[model samples]
Target: MLDRYGFEPAREAPDRVRLRNCPFHPLAAQAPDLVCGMNHAFLTGYLQGLRAPAVQAILAPSPGECCVELQDATEDGEGAAD
Candidate 1:
Protein backbone atom coordinates (compact mmCIF):
# COMPACT_ATOMS: atom_id res chain seq x y z
CA MET A 1 0.00 0.00 0.00
CA LEU A 2 2.80 2.38 0.82
CA ASP A 3 4.40 1.50 -2.48
CA ARG A 4 1.19 2.51 -4.16
CA TYR A 5 1.70 5.92 -2.64
CA GLY A 6 5.34 5.98 -3.80
CA PHE A 7 6.76 5.25 -0.36
CA GLU A 8 9.60 2.86 0.24
CA PRO A 9 11.28 1.71 3.41
CA ALA A 10 14.38 3.70 4.16
CA ARG A 11 15.19 2.30 7.58
CA GLU A 12 13.96 -0.52 9.78
CA ALA A 13 14.64 -1.46 13.39
CA PRO A 14 13.17 -3.83 15.91
CA ASP A 15 10.76 -1.15 17.07
CA ARG A 16 10.49 1.27 14.19
CA VAL A 17 10.21 1.68 10.45
CA ARG A 18 10.87 4.80 8.41
CA LEU A 19 9.83 5.30 4.85
CA ARG A 20 11.06 7.57 2.05
CA ASN A 21 9.85 8.82 -1.32
CA CYS A 22 6.55 10.37 -0.46
CA PRO A 23 4.45 10.74 -3.59
CA PHE A 24 2.27 13.16 -1.72
CA HIS A 25 5.02 15.73 -1.76
CA PRO A 26 4.41 19.34 -2.77
CA LEU A 27 0.75 18.88 -1.98
CA ALA A 28 1.71 17.60 1.45
CA ALA A 29 3.75 20.76 1.82
CA GLN A 30 0.75 22.88 1.01
CA ALA A 31 -1.56 21.11 3.46
CA PRO A 32 0.48 19.09 5.85
CA ASP A 33 -2.26 18.64 8.39
CA LEU A 34 -4.69 17.10 5.98
CA VAL A 35 -2.21 15.07 4.05
CA CYS A 36 -0.30 13.79 7.01
CA GLY A 37 -3.44 13.01 8.92
CA MET A 38 -4.81 10.96 6.07
CA ASN A 39 -1.52 9.18 5.66
CA HIS A 40 -1.39 8.32 9.34
CA ALA A 41 -4.96 7.09 9.31
CA PHE A 42 -4.41 4.95 6.26
CA LEU A 43 -1.44 3.19 7.77
CA THR A 44 -3.03 2.85 11.17
CA GLY A 45 -6.20 1.40 9.75
CA TYR A 46 -4.21 -0.93 7.60
CA LEU A 47 -2.37 -2.34 10.57
CA GLN A 48 -5.55 -2.64 12.57
CA GLY A 49 -7.27 -4.45 9.77
CA LEU A 50 -4.38 -6.86 9.66
CA ARG A 51 -4.89 -7.57 13.36
CA ALA A 52 -1.57 -6.09 14.41
CA PRO A 53 -2.82 -3.85 17.20
CA ALA A 54 0.57 -3.84 18.85
CA VAL A 55 1.99 -1.78 15.99
CA GLN A 56 0.95 1.76 15.38
CA ALA A 57 1.32 4.43 12.76
CA ILE A 58 2.72 7.82 13.64
CA LEU A 59 2.85 11.15 11.87
CA ALA A 60 6.48 12.12 11.94
CA PRO A 61 6.87 14.05 8.72
CA SER A 62 10.39 15.16 7.88
CA PRO A 63 12.03 16.74 4.90
CA GLY A 64 12.58 14.31 2.08
CA GLU A 65 11.01 11.51 4.06
CA CYS A 66 7.74 9.72 4.13
CA CYS A 67 5.18 11.37 6.38
CA VAL A 68 4.42 8.25 8.37
CA GLU A 69 6.27 5.88 10.63
CA LEU A 70 5.32 2.54 12.12
CA GLN A 71 6.43 1.77 15.64
CA ASP A 72 5.84 -0.68 18.39
CA ALA A 73 3.06 0.26 20.79
CA THR A 74 4.21 1.37 24.20
CA GLU A 75 3.62 -0.93 27.14
CA ASP A 76 1.70 1.90 28.80
CA GLY A 77 -0.87 1.49 25.99
CA GLU A 78 -0.21 4.69 24.09
CA GLY A 79 0.15 3.62 20.51
CA ALA A 80 0.39 6.38 17.97
CA ALA A 81 2.26 9.52 18.78
CA ASP A 82 0.65 12.92 18.70
Candidate 2:
Protein backbone atom coordinates (compact mmCIF):
# COMPACT_ATOMS: atom_id res chain seq x y z
CA MET A 1 0.00 0.00 0.00
CA LEU A 2 2.63 2.48 1.02
CA ASP A 3 5.05 1.39 -1.68
CA ARG A 4 2.30 1.58 -4.24
CA TYR A 5 1.66 5.06 -2.92
CA GLY A 6 5.23 6.27 -3.27
CA PHE A 7 6.71 4.93 -0.03
CA GLU A 8 10.25 3.57 0.00
CA PRO A 9 12.06 1.51 2.60
CA ALA A 10 14.70 3.25 4.62
CA ARG A 11 18.27 2.33 3.75
CA GLU A 12 18.95 1.81 7.45
CA ALA A 13 17.48 -0.63 9.94
CA PRO A 14 15.15 0.44 12.76
CA ASP A 15 17.90 0.21 15.34
CA ARG A 16 20.15 2.15 13.03
CA VAL A 17 17.62 4.91 12.30
CA ARG A 18 18.19 7.86 14.56
CA LEU A 19 15.36 9.31 16.66
CA ARG A 20 16.55 12.87 16.12
CA ASN A 21 15.46 12.50 12.51
CA CYS A 22 11.85 12.85 13.66
CA PRO A 23 10.60 9.78 11.80
CA PHE A 24 6.84 9.52 11.44
CA HIS A 25 6.97 6.15 13.15
CA PRO A 26 9.57 4.07 14.93
CA LEU A 27 8.45 1.03 12.96
CA ALA A 28 9.54 3.06 9.96
CA ALA A 29 12.86 1.53 10.77
CA GLN A 30 11.43 -1.99 10.33
CA ALA A 31 9.06 -1.48 7.44
CA PRO A 32 11.49 0.73 5.65
CA ASP A 33 9.63 -0.06 2.47
CA LEU A 34 6.10 0.87 3.50
CA VAL A 35 4.99 4.44 3.84
CA CYS A 36 3.74 4.70 7.41
CA GLY A 37 2.40 7.79 9.03
CA MET A 38 2.22 6.09 12.43
CA ASN A 39 4.96 3.50 12.90
CA HIS A 40 5.10 3.90 16.67
CA ALA A 41 1.46 2.96 17.03
CA PHE A 42 1.87 0.10 14.60
CA LEU A 43 4.84 -1.21 16.55
CA THR A 44 2.98 -0.78 19.85
CA GLY A 45 -0.07 -2.59 18.57
CA TYR A 46 2.04 -5.34 17.03
CA LEU A 47 3.81 -5.80 20.37
CA GLN A 48 0.42 -6.17 22.05
CA GLY A 49 -0.43 -8.89 19.48
CA LEU A 50 -3.13 -6.91 17.75
CA ARG A 51 -1.41 -6.61 14.38
CA ALA A 52 -1.67 -9.79 12.34
CA PRO A 53 0.87 -11.31 9.97
CA ALA A 54 -1.54 -10.87 7.11
CA VAL A 55 -1.67 -7.19 7.87
CA GLN A 56 2.08 -7.04 7.85
CA ALA A 57 2.21 -9.01 4.62
CA ILE A 58 -0.31 -6.67 3.11
CA LEU A 59 1.94 -3.82 4.10
CA ALA A 60 5.24 -5.24 2.89
CA PRO A 61 6.30 -8.20 0.77
CA SER A 62 9.82 -8.42 2.07
CA PRO A 63 10.73 -10.52 5.09
CA GLY A 64 13.08 -7.82 6.37
CA GLU A 65 10.28 -5.31 6.24
CA CYS A 66 7.75 -7.74 7.65
CA CYS A 67 9.50 -7.88 11.00
CA VAL A 68 11.01 -4.46 10.84
CA GLU A 69 9.58 -3.33 14.16
CA LEU A 70 10.86 -4.99 17.28
CA GLN A 71 8.30 -7.06 19.22
CA ASP A 72 10.18 -6.77 22.49
CA ALA A 73 9.98 -3.46 24.34
CA THR A 74 13.31 -4.09 26.04
CA GLU A 75 15.11 -2.70 22.98
CA ASP A 76 13.03 0.50 23.16
CA GLY A 77 14.74 2.61 25.82
CA GLU A 78 18.13 2.86 24.19
CA GLY A 79 17.12 6.12 22.55
CA ALA A 80 13.86 6.90 24.30
CA ALA A 81 12.86 10.51 24.03
CA ASP A 82 12.15 12.90 26.87
Candidate 3:
Protein backbone atom coordinates (compact mmCIF):
# COMPACT_ATOMS: atom_id res chain seq x y z
CA MET A 1 0.00 0.00 0.00
CA LEU A 2 2.92 2.29 0.74
CA ASP A 3 4.11 1.78 -2.82
CA ARG A 4 0.68 2.63 -4.09
CA TYR A 5 0.70 5.71 -1.91
CA GLY A 6 4.13 6.68 -3.29
CA PHE A 7 5.53 6.31 0.22
CA GLU A 8 8.62 4.29 1.05
CA PRO A 9 9.41 2.76 4.40
CA ALA A 10 11.37 5.02 6.72
CA ARG A 11 14.34 3.16 8.17
CA GLU A 12 14.87 3.23 11.92
CA ALA A 13 18.04 2.55 13.92
CA PRO A 14 19.59 -0.81 14.87
CA ASP A 15 17.42 -2.70 12.40
CA ARG A 16 17.37 -1.82 8.73
CA VAL A 17 13.68 -2.68 8.70
CA ARG A 18 11.41 -0.17 7.09
CA LEU A 19 9.59 2.27 9.32
CA ARG A 20 6.03 3.44 8.78
CA ASN A 21 4.12 6.55 9.67
CA CYS A 22 1.47 5.76 12.19
CA PRO A 23 -0.33 8.79 13.50
CA PHE A 24 -2.44 6.34 15.38
CA HIS A 25 0.28 5.14 17.70
CA PRO A 26 -2.06 5.76 20.59
CA LEU A 27 -4.43 3.10 19.35
CA ALA A 28 -1.65 0.54 19.52
CA ALA A 29 -1.33 1.05 23.23
CA GLN A 30 -5.05 0.55 23.59
CA ALA A 31 -4.94 -2.64 21.63
CA PRO A 32 -2.29 -4.52 23.54
CA ASP A 33 -4.38 -7.56 22.67
CA LEU A 34 -4.11 -6.73 18.98
CA VAL A 35 -0.96 -8.66 18.15
CA CYS A 36 -2.16 -11.58 20.25
CA GLY A 37 -5.86 -11.47 19.53
CA MET A 38 -7.80 -13.81 17.29
CA ASN A 39 -7.28 -13.24 13.55
CA HIS A 40 -5.84 -9.82 14.27
CA ALA A 41 -9.26 -8.29 14.53
CA PHE A 42 -8.00 -5.45 16.66
CA LEU A 43 -5.55 -4.49 13.98
CA THR A 44 -8.27 -4.74 11.40
CA GLY A 45 -10.28 -2.30 13.48
CA TYR A 46 -7.34 0.04 13.72
CA LEU A 47 -6.87 -0.11 9.97
CA GLN A 48 -10.54 0.49 9.34
CA GLY A 49 -10.10 3.74 11.22
CA LEU A 50 -7.14 4.76 9.08
CA ARG A 51 -8.99 4.41 5.77
CA ALA A 52 -12.43 5.58 6.59
CA PRO A 53 -13.20 7.36 3.31
CA ALA A 54 -12.60 4.26 1.25
CA VAL A 55 -13.47 1.31 3.42
CA GLN A 56 -12.60 -1.08 0.60
CA ALA A 57 -9.02 0.13 0.72
CA ILE A 58 -8.61 -1.49 4.11
CA LEU A 59 -9.77 -4.82 2.74
CA ALA A 60 -6.77 -5.11 0.46
CA PRO A 61 -4.16 -7.66 1.42
CA SER A 62 -1.24 -5.43 0.47
CA PRO A 63 -1.59 -3.48 3.69
CA GLY A 64 -2.09 -6.64 5.66
CA GLU A 65 1.45 -7.70 4.76
CA CYS A 66 2.73 -5.56 7.58
CA CYS A 67 0.60 -7.44 10.06
CA VAL A 68 1.78 -10.76 8.70
CA GLU A 69 5.36 -9.65 9.02
CA LEU A 70 4.63 -8.61 12.59
CA GLN A 71 3.27 -12.05 13.31
CA ASP A 72 6.44 -13.63 11.96
CA ALA A 73 8.57 -11.31 14.02
CA THR A 74 6.70 -12.18 17.19
CA GLU A 75 6.80 -15.91 16.41
CA ASP A 76 10.55 -15.66 15.94
CA GLY A 77 10.72 -14.61 19.63
CA GLU A 78 11.59 -11.05 18.71
CA GLY A 79 8.54 -9.99 20.73
CA ALA A 80 10.54 -10.73 23.86
CA ALA A 81 13.84 -9.38 22.62
CA ASP A 82 15.32 -6.35 24.28
Best candidate, TM-score: 1
Model 2: how far residue 19 lies from native, Å:
13
TM-score result, candidate 3: 0.25
In lDDT terms, which candidate is top? Answer: 1
Clashes of 3: 0
Clashes of 1: 0
lDDT (Cα atoms) of all candidates against the true structure: 0.79, 0.37, 0.34
Range of the 10 consecutive residues with the lowest summed lDDT in candidate 2: 52-61
Residues 1-82, candidate 2, lDDT per residue (tens digit)? 2344223434345433212232334565655545343554554454347543222211222333333333223344432221
Sorted on lDDT, best first, the list reads 1, 2, 3
Models sorted by TM-score, best on top: 1, 3, 2
Model 3 misplaced stretches (Cα beyond 4 Å): 3-8, 12-15, 35-82
Candidate 1 ranges beyond 4 A from true positions? 75-82
What 10-residue stretch in candidate 1 is worst by lDDT?
A: 73-82
